[model samples]
Target: MSLSTTSLRSPRVVVIGAGVGGLAAAALLARQGLDVRVIERGQQPGGKLSQLAVGPSLLDAGPTVLTMRWVFDALFERLGQSLDEQLSLRPCAVLARHAWGPEERLDLLADLEASVTAMADFAGPAQGQRYLAFCERAKEIYDTLEQPFLRSQRPTPWSLAWRVGMSRLPQLARISPFRTLWQELGRYFPDPRLRQLFGRYATYCGSSPFDAPATLMLVAHVEREAVWQIEGGMHRLAQSLAALCQRQGVQISYGREAREILLRQGRVCGVALDQDAPLQADAVLFNGDVDALRQGLLGQPLRQAMGGRPLTSARRSLSAVTWHLQAEVGGFPLSHHNVFFSDPADEGYRREFADIAAGRLPAAPSVYVCAQDRTGDPMPRHSGQAERLMCLVNAPATADARPLTEEELLLCQAQMFARLTQAGLKISPSVHPLQRTSPQDFARRFPATGGALYGQASRGWRASFQRPASTTRVPGLYLAGGSVHPGPGLPMAALSGQLAAEQICAALRSTRRWQPVAMPGGMSMR
Candidate 1:
């Protein structure tokens, strides 16, 4: 359900970060006539929606694929702008191209029938029918929770069961919360290869299929519903939203960090920024990881906002080692998205998870390559003489440790490229526009939290509610980002910001008239 927000009279809201959650909240609240100011420590608006440089070629460093387009469409629609009009997007015909080796390749296409045919050709008719059934169950999980859990402020299994009614409680069981995704996939896919392909969805949130909740299979249905490629790059999607925020009268300040969250009484008032005077406001929305709040990075007094539940390093999710490459390649027929699985004997998924559990990099990592320059056409595509590509190899959540040593980095890089070459994507080391990002690098990029990309992993059915809600123990404070409720992914983070804006609007509506809101200078958390 959408909030009926009326225009307000200059109530100030200071968003501490300019990431997707920050940008979305600011844009929507600005539309509600709130005086929104977005401050970022970086030069660009996007936090995780970052880009890498290879000579003149730039590749998207994070989130190469875009799915759940409706989330974005709704956000833009509320601002009186069409998402399609603001930016060009092409629907991907081939959702993903998967390969085990040179002779073993499968293309999951946009069309379900096409995919069924392809799967049948790859496996057999029985397997193809089972694939369709898998899609059905995946869709059921998404449809069951999309309303009560996904769109709500915060939800629990009890709340979800109540929403679904006692009669539909069996659907909850059907979601298989008790089983790991690997076990659940076995019921539908007897072939280990197919299981591996579908189970890879667990890593979408940086979790292992062997242990992640079976509910995560909903990801397959989510992506299969629709996928699009924004023009220019995924980073451009962030730029477009930032532009919309500016156009809607949001006061955006970059290169500024929030020194601390200001408080008046037990409630939030605004933020104190570095190198400038502290700006006061009615409330503050923290759009970074909740772990930052628990660590008292914002301020010790602000820890009260956490409502006593603190985040620990033990529950943090997975991290990665990514290579952004700009090069001219031959041989391998690259697609917009591709994956090269490691040896089957190693139980690639199990072995990799074990290595991460031990804080050691995987011996034979499953590599994901995104040829950013490649389009959906049958023939390969690129803008210039060379192409931009990126390969991501999963690694342990090691953002808190010392950056990998030279020897370790070399070994990881060697292991990654060797598998890539063996899987038919042969590229010379001389490839221009090459850069590598380690887990420690990610930690530095997004402070406090180790390089856990998806915040906390969705370990079980109960894991979803472990994240804090939009409204915290502190009356006027709010949480919005991947680290909070609704789980991780680009769309979920954007939705989180939207939910935060709605909550703030509701609270303000109860406290005052449409006149205005302000703060005092003498405010202190202590």
Candidate 2:
């Protein structure tokens, strides 16, 4: 059921930011026969889902993993497009490889039984059995929340509980919102190595395992479902989305920054772009961090629109320091996704988070290295050529206030490389260009965020409920991004955008000029 384009007055929607959230919203709204325009400050599409130039190769600068691909598939399908037709995707067999020392390494394969057998070989029969049990529990948690929480429009605790019903209260309790992720992992893995490995899931949401809720374990299940390697790069997904939006009649203006969301009579009326005339719209969808509104980065009106609330630094999520390079490497075999862990014997894992919590860089941080070239191709494909790699470590989100000094970053780099060397992987120095992005760099890239990558940290159980929903106090202004509900990551952000679009269409249904029709399964243009 799509809205009639022949209607006298079509709803005009302006989406600020060309991030996945903004792109997704623009695409959907345009498909519904509404006039949609997307404005991005950057020259290209993809906000965090971007690429960096490293010498002759382009390395993925942000997220490398692509999970929950159905989110995109369904989105494209609704837009009368096929994701497979638009982009090439290769399934990844090896989910990731984790290393603690030179010889001590574990690989989690895409196959569940294979991962279980590998765990058994690495830890023992008991550990293997525990891994199986953990998988079951993780699956249960994912299934339990998939409909009531993830797919729902920013459900509160009470609403979510009601959706779960009285009969499933036991299942709700099993989610273990009261306990931290670190504390919950103990029930599944006695070995500290396994605990550390599993606890790393918290970092997916830019959170510390010691503070994040046990519900984060569902991330393990999400990964187990599937991981795909996009041909070219993950940024290709952004390109495809942008292309689709244009085809759907969405006007996407690159290198255009939205300075303010204009309001008339306390309702969104237009958007004021940097150094340009304002764009009149019936509704506005903001795809950047909600904190930007609270902090008055966009405009003073946005602060008042947000009711003058401030997001504390303590609630901010983890930032990252990344080194993207195209380099020759040797020693330990590299997988597409790899993790070099800090020594657990010396409590380095706990200390890492504690140091970040105190706004200090960890002495020895756990590093994540993404071998972009190795994802879909055979090892022989890059026999002699340089591999594009992105090495990242979690850091404090205080770079906006106190940027990391060159001396401090140099020392941190040395320490990070030392950990890589200890894991038996070595990089050959070359004339190839390397891009080092500090938390301050991220802060500059995305305004109003002190380099907090995934919005506010998923610290307490209430944190999920605290994220602002699509509908805000402002009548015609909505929020959609990683900072909002359904949590962070590419798929989650896309869902947030879809939710905002739905809300916009539903609200506009009350107007006399346009009547957008929604079908049982989706929205359509009549």
> Which candidate number maximizes TM-score?
2
What tens-digit string does per-residue lDDT give for candidate 1 at 195-289? 88998999998788887889998999998987888889999988998999999899888889888887776777768888778887777899988
Residues 190-270 of candidate 2 have per-residue lDDT tens digits of 888999999999999999999999999999999989988898999999999999999989999988988888777677788
Best by lDDT: 2
TM-score of 1: 0.94
Clashes of 2: 6
Q: What TM-score does each of the candidates earn? A: 0.94, 0.96
- Candidate lDDT values, in order: 0.82, 0.87
In candidate 1, which residue pairs clash?
A: 54-433
Candidate 1: Cα lDDT at 350 = 81
Off by over 4 Å in 1: 1-9, 304-310, 382-384, 429-433, 515-526
Error of 2 at 5 (Å): 17
lDDT of 1 at 31: 81
